[model samples]
Target: MILVVLGTHELPFDRLLKKIDKQILLGNINEEVLVQAGHTKYYSKNMQIFDFTTYEHMADLYRKANFIITHGGTGSITMGMKMGKKVIAVPRLIKYGEHNDDHQLEIVKQFQETGHILYWSEPMSLSEVLRLVKSFNPVKFESGNKKIISLIKQFIDGA
Candidate 1:
């Protein structure tokens, strides 16, 4: 199963949904597709979609999924990576009115550079990326917040 997760951004990420729906229509995606659409309103006969779901239910989906396609939200991507799932992150862009800024792109790029996930930047072909996903291996995501945590610990100790 393929899990598609569009995070709770205020605007809709209909573009990514449309592309996935189209790919399913063309038989490029043969696996069962599940989506957490969040605020995006997308209708697809090929996908089992929910506008919103409980965190526990979402966790079940994440566990059952073979791979994950998600927005560039760090939490979602990090969760998938930590689960050892191949994650493809598509950034919500301001030009598409999906976000107020392109900050998600920066996060996606950094994760991509670290080999923790795949990034679908603008002008990149979703089809090609989907093809690549068939054999993609994501590196394990190690927590980088230790430095911040250590500083906090030192501050508390000195206090």
Candidate 2:
């Protein structure tokens, strides 16, 4: 199963959905696709689309997914990364009204540069990126909270 996540942003990320739908129509994607469509109101017979879902439900979907294709939201991208899942992130560009700014571009680029995820951007088709997923191995994600807590504990002990 392939999980597509569009975070809880008000803007419609129909652009990404359309691309995926095209792939399905072309038979490039033969697996089941589950989508967390958020505010993007799109109907696709090829996919199971949900307007919104609880955190627990989403987590379950993430676990069941073979890999994830997600918008360039930090939370969504990191969730897939932290789960050790291969992530293909597509940034929501301002020119398309998918986002208010191009910040998502930076976020996706950083993750891609760090070897945490692959990204779909201009001049690269999603199908091209999808073809790479079979061989992509994401770097494991380690939360910084543990290190922060350790530092605080050491400070208290010293004091």
Candidate 3:
């Protein structure tokens, strides 16, 4: 029961979808092209393809999912981390024509440095990464003046 999110970005799925068992793909799609690109009839059977109409609905799905595999979106990453869910964030690159730039990669690096999220560069190892999620122990940030200042600095510096 993996929540395989494609985010708002209508990125390619051919490689990523191949690694999951039971997936729920949430995002844009071209149903006709998906099949032609070898998305397989598996989506029609074992998986769900949804276009989230609102942010609340999307949040609901995020809360309900077992594991979160997403593109490197800070909002999604933060949501998953706050929920203490298994998150494997793969960055989207402009060279891949999947995003405006390589900002996601940098975000992924920063998230990894904080030890709050897991990242997978290649889709082929998603199973191994998912397995590792079960034993992962995330650092729970203790809130205080120090934490507040750190968070503020993060926003100011990153921005």
The candidate that wins on lDDT is 2
Residue pairs clashing, model 1: none
lDDT of 3: 0.64
Off by over 4 Å in 1: 145-148, 151-159
The CA lDDT at 37 in model 2 is 94
Q: Per-residue alpha-carbon lDDT of model 2 for 47-159, expressed as tens digits? A: 99998989999999999999999999999999899899999999999999999999999999999999999999877988889899989999899899999999999999999
- Candidate 3 lDDT over 14-102, as tens digits, reads 34555443232432221222111122223554356554446686677667776677778887787778787777788877776767888
List the lowest-lDDT window of 10 residues for candidate 3. 30-39
Descending-TM-score candidate ranking: 2, 1, 3
Q: Candidates' lDDT values, in order?
A: 0.90, 0.94, 0.64
RMSD of each: 1.7, 1.3, 8.1
For residue 122, give model 1's deviation from the true position in Å: 2.8
Per-candidate clashes, comma-separated: 0, 0, 0
Best by TM-score: 2
lDDT string, candidate 1, 1-159, tens digits? 999999898799989989898888888899999999999988888899888888888888898998899999988998898888999999999999999999999999998998888889769888889999888888877776998899999999999
For model 3, the superposed segments whose C-alpha errors exceed 4 Å read: 10-14, 21-44, 141-159
